[model samples]
Target: MTEIIDGNAVASQIRDDLTAAIETLADAGARPGLATVLMGDDPASQTYVNMKQRDCEEVGIESHHVDVDGDASPAELYDAIADLNEDPDVHGYIVQAPVPDHVDYREVIRRVDPIKDVDGFHPENVGRLVAGDARFRPCTPHGIQKLLETAGVEPEGKDVTIVGRSDIVGKPLANLLIQKAEDGNATVTVCHSRTDDLGAKTRSADIVVAAVGVPELIDGSMIGEGAVVIDVGVNRVDVSERRSEDSQTASDQSDTEKGYELVGDVEFESAKEKASAITPVPGGVGPMTRAMLLYNTVKAASLQEDVAVDLP
Candidate 1:
């Protein structure tokens, strides 16, 4: 029987483990704090920020939020970042992506103090990651590593093919898996839209990570037998759209109240049949991403407050 990797269980364990570290910091009179800065009123972004705030509260991290008008000037957003940088209580913060078109997201990232950069998109952090001295690993990639560890799928000597080249997931993950650490040392192949013979590359690997934005791009045929599959894409497809036989069953389709359903880069049902272990779309990488963000916030607080706390 193939193992369905349970991300919720693993993430819950991580949250539970962090509670002690958070309490330790609290004893030192320095409770860890995290902040979210949303520039526009994007509904998805707002929902994500709200969930993050709730996670922080659950783990004893003080939560703060800053909102900028959708039409606000770039400088105004920067001012909010500047204020957060100066606030002692806010040990870490993230400026939610998809800022106004007029604002250069890169410039906004540059304006944030690297110490409080919980999202780990700053040039300095990226550089550190490439150099294998990462102070903050990007959340999704770190969560993937933790998931792999929990599933007993060691990447040390295995071949890993990551589908996608975006800086957020692909580039960083490739860099991480090839490093000299325990979670590193994997032979990594990065594929993109222009890559020739994508299936051949994926089929030859011992582990496949489908992070490309396209929904259900990789299927069972592309996955090697007994290989581990990690799906990182969460896409919403129209309920009326035709789905493959492996997509969803009639009973499972009842939850599409929003006229859409969530899917991943890999076609789950087909891929699960061939893989030794796989992560589900909604319960797999999503929770891990959020969990790692909280981990980074706690680390940021520990570094700033000089508080010694054992991190899980």
Candidate 2:
């Protein structure tokens, strides 16, 4: 029987484990706090920030938000980041992605204090990660590692084929996986759109991670039997034309809010058949990102406030 990796269940257990550390921080009079800075009104960005705030509330982390106009000057945004760095109340913070086109996003990352860069995008934190002495791992890649651990699928000595080269997910994950550490020691191959014969690489891998933004890119034939599959893409695909006449007899298709539905880079219907374990799109990697953010905030508080708390 194929096992479905349940990220929601795994994330819930992590939250439970974190509650004890949170209590410890509270006892020391140092409740962890996380802040997010937004520069635009992108719907997706707004939704993401709102979810983070909600997660912070549930996890006992004080949440703060700063909204900058989409047209704001780069200096204005830079000042906000600097203020967060000096604020005693905020242990960590993230500047939401897709800042104004005029702003140098990379510069924004460089300006953030490495110690408070909970997102781990700053060059200093990224450098530490590459050196195998990371102060803070980026949340998505870090969350993916935790998910693999929870599923009893260690990367040590395994062949991992990651299908993306973006700095956020692909590059960092590849670096971490190839390191000589607990979640490390894996042989990793990073592939991008330019990579030729992608299937040949995936078929040889013990684990396949699909992170490219394309929807339903990898199918069962590309995956070797008994391999673990992790889908990290979240794309909304238009399924209106594909709807079958018999799909939903009771519901009116016209009444649907949108014509699109969520999908991942891997074709789940086909990949699950040959995989030993796999994660679903909406409930899989999505929850782990938020969970790790909370985890990082707590850890940051422990280090900055000199509060001793046992973290898992």
Top candidate on lDDT is 1
Candidate 2 — what's its lDDT?
0.91
Q: What does the lDDT read for residue 136 in candidate 1?
A: 94
lDDT of 1: 0.94
Q: So what's the TM-score on candidate 1?
A: 0.97
Which tens-of-lDDT digit does each residue in 124-181 have in candidate 1? 9999999989989999999999999999988999999999999899999999999999
Q: Give Cα distance to truth, residue 211, candidate 1, Å.
A: 0.4
Error of 2 at 237 (Å): 0.7
Off by over 4 Å in 1: 243-253
Candidate 2: tens digits of C-alpha lDDT, residues 179-275: 9898889999999999999999999999999999999999999999999999999998766655765784444365245666788999998999999
Q: Candidate 2 — which residues are off by over 4 angstroms?
A: 248-255
Candidate 2, 254: how far from true, in Å? 9.8
